[model samples]
Target chain A: MSWESFFQNLSNGISLGGLYALIAIGYSMVYGILRLINFAHGDIFMLGAYIAFYGMLIFSLPWWLSLIVSIILTAFIGILIDKGAYKPLRNAPRISALITAIGVSFFLENLGLVVFGGRPKGFYRPHIFDEIITIKGVRILSLTFYSLVITAIFLVLLFYIVYRTKTGLGMRAVSTDMETARLMGIDVDKIISITFAIGSGLAAVGGVLWAMKYPQINPLMGIFPGLKAFIAAVLGGIGSVGGALLGGFILGIAEIMLVAFMPQLSGYRDAFAFLILILILLVKPTGLLGVEVKEKA
Target chain B: MPFFKADHLVMRFGGLVAVNDFNLELQPGDLVGLIGPNGAGKTTVFNMITGVYRPTSGRIYFQDKDITGKRPDIITALGIARTFQNIRLFTDLSLIENVMVSYHVRLKSNIFEAVFKLPRYMRQENAMYEEAMELLHKVELDHLAEEKAGSLPYGEQRRLEIARALATHPKLLLLDEPAAGMNPNETLQLMDFIKQIRDEFDLTILLIEHDMKVVMGICERIWVLDYGKTIAVGTPSEIQNNPEVIKAYLGEEEYA
Candidate 1:
């Protein structure tokens, strides 16, 4: 009930939302172009965090370099996934690609479980991001500032890429009509691969920041955050990037505020998020920013 | 070297031979027409040449190089571009942006430059913007460059499609039913527009049309298909006089 506690919760909620937004952008971007749900995207997030973890721990690289290295590596991994699992199924029925996505997801999760071991370990907290400051009697975690700053930076870059650039034109065109894009001389596959690269790269940042917030390393750590972010994507009208960000912050604030206002419902936060999604679907069908894209008959 | 050639093309689906041994050749700067009734495999033939469908048996050559089985984008890069039977404008994009998508193939800036908005990216983007607007102007759509393409009137959308295709710097352009839904006034303007672009761009143009007036008026040479076979090829007057072509269009009673 205290204003101080409310502000603290709000801060934490926004930080969490920032991470969710990043991952949701990944989900939305891929879905925007391919209309594929990309169930394996969450696993890619897990892979990213793990990659960064080993980059720092095994290679003894600094956190910054490890972050960059993890992002680049994960991007290629994304392209590899598209080539390996999704590309061949492109001409197949939509359901086939969807099923393969789930399959790829399960494979990665189990791969993580076996290779990384089942036990949870403490996530390495880079010292600089461990600092906490108080503002007007409300405590602020440094990770909050870091996550928000990083998310803001990436979102700006994304806006430029999606709206202001040539490749972005190709992205929108491919999403509109893949065949027409090809006829127009846009390399559909290359655009697709770049989409995965950008989406997966953003997920890498989300994973790193997410680990910093949760401070737990486990094979299945991505499950909850990934699921939550995917919900955010759907809630934000699955194909719109700005919608994802809005959906993320909305979902984040709603969850934190729910638990804050009623401790009794703390365990129900996840359920509440899904509850919001169901309501949006029933009421609007299209997410807040989703335009009804008519399929040509 | 033929500017464009599709030789002995055949496309079969299960028991149906959609296009049987269909062939076409275009000399540089020629405007050709393909006309057939519905299901006559005109569009199917277009698909084979543009890489939308693999011909069961055929050879497609462009600029003397065999381009059969190449992907659509590669074929496009070899200076071929096309519009869809149903307009395929990037509906969400602004009219100018639609044209810019066609320029994607020629853009030299890489992803890093794009994301960072480096001088190189800014330079190319500026150039692309100017060029895209010019293309829109050709279609008389420059004033509405900021509007979503899907929001354009039916006739304007068709014009935008042609403008977008031309932005690819194509040596050969294929338009599938470009005047499909146009009013007679729009169709007349389109005929003139098509002729203008062929001369202005020095392009080889191929079009599939059911509109006999437009086809007969503009096409220097017309090829007709009946039941997936080329039934006639000649000047418009010759095609109109050909007994077989008349029989193909109307039934046996009309020939009597």
Candidate 2:
């Protein structure tokens, strides 16, 4: 491949990796604290895109306002899902919560189909995102630049919240031992709700950016990205946020590079994620950054 | 009125009655010990008071508040803190982080302020970090504040658990087996440490200990349980000399 094409592919890969990291952080965080897989996460991503789409086209809101509204609404829905579906099962077996997560995923998908309809709609990106910047010989989309910058900001903010703040300390404590966290006067349920809100909000951001890149929106649009990001989260380490970020970048760059170099392998691109998942599980079950945390009894 | 009280607390696990109609009262600055043979449901009584397991029947009160079956965090916020039998520290977290977590319930700033790095959040966070360091200093673990709680040796882990609990500014502290794995020398130090904390913090402490030496050395009063029933309650020397307590400890055949 020519140097320019290689640079283009690298930019594309990194941008895609940013989206995966955004989505994967949600998965890793919820898993870290609650030990729940949150299968509905992908559907929440889809809902975000649709909300932004409708906000712009139907409500005629400004792009920024619509994006903000979508994020807030998606975050609210995320908290509602936890309060309704997962909170009741807090003391239930872990398997029960996992199964309920799968059930919640289906419920959201069908809910989307009923509400948003089955047809695919075009996602209208703001004009700024459509501009192409020629950097030396390489052509980079402004959307890719925005995605990378926005993703970096979110990651930094998340790290600060998790490591620097008292709430973050509570989150780490809760993840370590819920009963002990409670004994420390940390409100375990509130921490959990906050976690869901943050995770879902980030997922919404990922979904909106994802729609801009692909320029398509459907009820099922989140399925591929969702699954792929989950694979990235696992490949990095399911319960570690840094691991998820690493996993996302690796998966994204690898996918783009593999497809770019070997056109014939494009058909198996989705399969590649599952293969990575299995290999990571077999090789280092904790993912790259995951410490082996004992499940609370 | 008692500073802390458990009225008719009962705990049952299916067919087994773990603790039966247990009752206790502590005045301010009381240092009491609960002791029993293995499976005597001593920990179960602790569980009920700390809101770990809601009593099958009974109420727990602290500072004249009817705290029966309240959520554990609420109970903790009401100035009760506890350490565990197995040393439940946030093992993966640094010692400072573990103690800092205790300040969470008392934090005035909410998540929005924390996430946005608002001034109130920064002020409170700095205060919390300093207070946590002070707590570590009290436990003599301040030098190792950056180390993971799990990496600390067994005796230090116990002290860290107490430091973490103390960071909540609790008026009442429950310690379950605080000296379980300690040697005699360490146990003596722990007795002094426990008494010092009780006096320094103005705390009413209820302890469960297998170390009779530590209990005899420091506790003002002792409650002995066998098969979930309180067999004796008195000064430490009285507990040692009680016939029923002796039988409970030595077994019926040995007592005979």
Error of 1 at A267 (Å): 1.4
Tens-digit lDDT track for model 2 on A6-93? 9999999999999999999999999999998998999999999999999999999987788889989999999999999999999899
User: In candidate 2, which residue pairs get closer than 3 Å at backbone N, Cα or C atoms, i.e. clash?
Assistant: none
lDDT by residue (B1-256, candidate 2, tens digit) is 6898889888999999999989999999999999889999998887788788989998888888998888889988899988889888888899998888877778899777987889988898898889999999998999999999889999999999899889888999999999999999998899989999998999999999887777777899999898999889999778877889888883443222
Per-residue lDDT of A31 in model 1: 88
Error of 2 at B32 (Å): 0.6
CAPRI quality level assigned to candidate 1 from its DockQ score = high
Put down candidate 1 lDDT per residue, A1-297, tens digits, no spaces: 899999999988898888899999999999888888999999899999999999988999998788899899999999999999999988888889999999999999999999999898777988878888888899888878888998899899888888877788789888888888888888999999999999999999998888888888788887888889998998988888999999898899889999999999999988998898889889987798888865421
TM-score (all chains, Cα) for each model: 0.97, 0.98
User: What value does the lDDT take at residue B252 in candidate 2?
Assistant: 43
- Report how far residue B6 has shifted in candidate 1, in Å: 1.4
The TM-score measured for candidate 1 stands at: 0.97
Tens-digit lDDT string for candidate 1 (B1-256): 6778889998999999999888888899899999878899999988888888989998999999999989999888889889889988888888988888866778888878887778987888888889989898888999999999989988898999999899989999999999999999999999999999999999999999988888889999999998899998998888888889887873432321
Task: Provide the DockQ value for model 2.
Answer: 0.84
